[model samples]
Target: MTTRTMLQRPAFHWLAAAWPYALIGLVTLLVRSPTFGNPILDFDEQLYLLVGDRMLHGHLPYVDLWDRKPVGLFALYAAIRLLGGSGIIQYQLIATACVVIAAWFVRAIVRRHMGEIPAIVAAVAYVLMLNVLHGLGGQTAIFYNALTAFAAWCACKANDANTPGRIAALALAAMLALGLAIQIKYTVIPEGIFFGCWFVWRLFAAGERLRRLLGIAIAMVLVALAPTGLALGAYALAGHLDAFLFANFTSIFLRQPFPTQVRNDQISQVVACCMALLTTAGVGLFQLRTHAHGRVYADFPLLAGWWVSAFAGFGMLGDFYDFYFLPVVLPSVILGAFALRGERRGFTFGCLLLLWPCIFIPANYFSRHQGILQTSRMVSAISPYVSGHCLYIYDGPTILYYLTNACIPTRFAFPDHLTNPIETRALGVDPVEEERRVLASQPGAIVTASRSVVPRVAPATQALVREALVRDYVLIARTPTIDRTYYIWARRDLHPGPAPLVDPRAANPQ
Candidate 1:
């Protein structure tokens, strides 16, 4: 073949290899189903959903729920509620869409760095990765992962010499995405820091003049600050400056260590977590050595740093859970895919054999097969009956929020000395006093974990609750399962109120 034809053949071959990535993307979207059946799992997820539902009904997020997340997430949730209707299925679908998009971005980044086969493998591994699969229902997990992948893609594009303008645009886009991700979960801050430094380093290495680099840096900063600035402005205009500052900025910065009750101690769980960290670190180091002199892929280092930082950070918090590391694991798989590149086919098969067992064993053994699902369904069934009200729940916010479309407030308890002074003071108040205050002020149902309630409450408080239930309220439903207790209490005197006017398009600007 002529030289021109030889060159064209390689380009054609590369284009042909893209089919697998497209196939993986299609399969990922097809497999998208509501895995957990109900939107509630962890307390935080449920809280956010309730807040979102309230926002849909013309209530502001931080102002009403006293939540810490950025306005962007609330806005997204509000939009989803508008389009999909007031159902957990709609929320699940939106979260699923975010995962699918994130998967596609992962494939794109891998394809750019390693080529088609490895990229396809990485994308599949990303969707199938145990954390991603299990935490698909989580709002922060889904949004943050998607945002991280998009940021990585932008960083990669930014590093390309042939497309400087395109790179600048992509870099700015990445910074904005990073800002949103940071709002969703504070863990994304390191991603922005690492990539910002990398941008400077690349500019210096390329002999770009200082003045031009400074200008570029300024532009990037403005782009990054745009979303955050907008969110702050929204809160300020709504007369919720205190809530915005205390919840989003101060409270998040002062996150307390996890409580002892939620801490995990299983030997296998510990081993699996350790292995995952080791594998990720090993792959990252290998990539650094191999690509040290090559063009920056951007995804590898950002993800590797996210993994190390989140693990170290969450490990310091005593009540760590598996889902806490969900955002970091997506990039780890992509890095692992790069590490497995060029290996013999047989070796790849062996790795899969070892990996499958590690991934499935914990999921099958520890996760109560249908326990969470059942709890979620039961809660959802009773939510409509108590829609325009508050729920006092003792445990698991996920199920409560998923079921009732109302915010369930838990009495905040201080387990760490590091807690904010205000929060500590609030927790210091007697539980009886607090429960009484809530009962008198917030007209709603009170659901308690039967076993926990029977033992934990003092005699006086227990008697008061029983009296209220018998005289003032009626037992609407009771769902008892092997590992959970659900009781729905509706007020007898307060008849079913008018359906709250929920405006789906009230708050979402974009």
Candidate 2:
């Protein structure tokens, strides 16, 4: 059979086609197992867990607790929380499942160009490459990557459809998938734009009239935006459209820009983390370019458009942190498999060996050993002290709230909003003023990380928290980590003011 025939080949009976997914699922867990249950796995995941927990207990996203991420992201976590108690293991497992599903999509998409064995290798690499960029946990990209890949697959189906009705069905499905992905992370917008144009162009190529195409374009756009529109509608019904708008949209612009040098350094770090990927994937693309008109050239533009759009977003949104690279991982790896088109299984493993060293660098930042396990010890220490009051995290992990079973005294509970210099002005509220309020509220306990370790510390806010610590709170427990120590401070008024200190003579009427 020809390559295109293989692409369009009917799936085997369910039993025959089920093994790849089953194998990929097991590989995902085995690779991701180390980081499971690590609450402090990623700071962003920590916030998601906290939001999910708080959301269950009558709190809302923007109004009740502040974060600029879309509500869908929080809603996903909230759903994860329902799997049981706190959602640490649950979210990780769900994220792993997402990775596995996404890998399957990757294999399905690239198989036409790169045959079955190499295509499967490409899929496994996507899962393994995630660790190279800290995608081992519940990063927003974890969920949306799968959704975006599914959307791309739908678009591919549209490309393959011979019947008009089938084409329309696949196009709408792709648009709706992209729309849901937007609710999860706005970064996917660039890729969505590509898919939108792809649909319009495909319909135009199919000889649809301009007016009908216009209507189709409008419908696709609306479908993609519907989830976000629904989220806003919910907020509107509660009469807090402004709060939702500001938190979800405006607050991001409020953040201070990083210094040029710092951003350059971040870009450098991302590049370093991706070194092996670049070497191997880069060589593959070069090989394809040299051999463009060969049999491995099916639907090349579709993948290229998706890859370039995501890559541009990654480049332009520098310093948004490295997880921005996660979405780029999908297309790059599949495209990279272009090198293995007619090669043996040995070449697949050879390509993977190049990515091995790159994995360990970013992998160090997260691990079951490096993350929440150490500081979780402080939970037992701070739990008794913070029994009935909020536990303020001045410059520490946000997961402590979930761990210690304490409330956050303020909405700016995500520490970066207050403690990170780059976020000094980004949150709608004043970070320092918010910090003052948390300290002033006399929280049951406070957590702070070593300045050396948490480099994003805002000097002014750090000073303020330090002064508050000396004046009103006392150091209770210090937890050591790979980098430095994280300190827990308890409110000094642990005693009940010495029972109001009444004079004996006055009580006796002397």
lDDT by residue (1-510, candidate 2, tens digit) is: 887766665674564678877887787788788888777777788898899888999899988889889999999999988899558889999999899889999889877656777677778888877886768788988899999999888877777765655666777898898888988888899999998888777787777778887888898899999999999999999999999999888777776677777777777877777665666667667666676563334366777788889887676544646678889888877777776644474476456634563446454445576566675687877898777888887666788888877888988888777777777776777778877787788888877765433345677777777677667766666676665567776777884333222222211100
For each candidate, the alpha-carbon lDDT, in order, equals 0.57, 0.77
Clashing pairs in model 2?
Answer: 254-426, 255-426
Best by TM-score: 2
True-structure lDDT of candidate 1: 0.57
lDDT of 1 at 125: 60
- Candidate 1's error at 93, in angstroms? 2.1
Q: Estimate each model's TM-score.
A: 0.75, 0.90
Worst 10 residues of 2 by lDDT: 501-510
Q: State the TM-score for model 2.
A: 0.90
What local lDDT score does residue 306 receive in model 2, on the 0 to 100 scale?
83
